[model samples]
Target: MLTLQIYLNRITTQHNGATLDYRGQFSNSRLIVADFTQFVNDIQAALKSAAEKNIYTPPSKLFGNLRATPICLDVREQLADGLSPVEYKVLLETLMAVCNSRAVKPEQVLYHGKIPFQAA
Candidate 1:
């Protein structure tokens, strides 16, 4: 049910031209879908305008050897990211136990999951 709620929120929020909330309420998929939709629309509009103006697309070296593929770095995903379950667990635990009130992060916290809310 939470997934469905997130989806509904994404559609309504986007159509209403509201900023996306990613911290708590929105799910990863919801945010991704909404962002991708907007990105596609923007690219389409730009390309259409360029075509109308007869602007030639400059050749890009984004794809190492594949000219046909528009290799955008931001959209590329690392297969190892999903393959590394242990790494993901450690990362999530580190985020959850974050206790900094200031913008800067403190070092030397033990990874045994014993971080107190306050240091002092």
Candidate 2:
């Protein structure tokens, strides 16, 4: 569900009757060469730590791109801040992603704050 943008900008454009979009020196290329496995780990760890810390508020990455950082979510502490739909969706998806990859089932994902959501 990550909407990646890898499009090249227009090669030519005119503003003051002159081209400004195609100057190679003025433009720089950005390649988002990502490691999928590392991305997965980053997200999984973020969500897992959130649950562990009881985070519930919407995170910065929830409505945007996720990065490798220790931005935890303490749900009990964040309920006051509330969350937008986008954040909720992202949080759910993140949790599910971590759970599925770790072989933790849905029922097992919310068990009293333990890894696997709970100890079986």
Candidate 3:
């Protein structure tokens, strides 16, 4: 199983909108996403797609460093094929759970999961 961790560093709300500062860690690599609300939306959409289609396509924005890394669900499976439909659902649920928590101010561990991994 692969372990993934996401931390929400801070949230800034303005009259126009709210921006979230967060980071994700998988293995030795760490990714920082700053002031991106679309990231959350993309995750939610991917979760819906995974549920409806049993397939996950990672968000384009995360395609670079984040997606390039090998975060496998199983030792024998490639990253692309590691996650089962149920696993995908659970992974997204874990993330959404953290997102829904609405923990503001101070850094918070948004998500932590050990799963057969893959994310759309």
Clashes of each: 0, 7, 2
Candidate 3 or 1, higher lDDT: 3
Q: TM-score for all predictions?
A: 0.21, 0.25, 0.25
Residue by residue across 1-120, what tens digits does model 3's lDDT show?
A: 111233333222111232322222221212223323543543444344332443333324545324422212111223343334553444344444433432211111122223333233
Q: How far is candidate 2 from the true structure (C-alpha RMSD, Å)?
A: 18.7
Off by over 4 Å in 1: 1-34, 57-120
Best by lDDT: 3
Clash list (residue pairs), candidate 2: 54-74, 54-75, 55-73, 55-74, 55-75, 56-74, 56-75
* lDDT of candidate 2 over 1-120, digit per residue (tens): 111111122122222343322211211232111233443355444344433544322235454323322222212212223433443334345445543333323332221232122223
**Candidate 2: what lDDT?**
0.30
- Winner of 2 and 3 under lDDT: 3
Q: Of models 1 and 2, which has the larger TM-score?
A: 2
Error of 3 at 110 (Å): 9.5
- Better by TM-score, candidate 3 or 1: 3
Ranked candidates (lDDT, high to low): 3, 2, 1
Taking all chains together, the TM-score of candidate 2 against the true structure is 0.25
Instruction: Give the worst 10-residue stretch by lDDT in candidate 1.
Output: 1-10
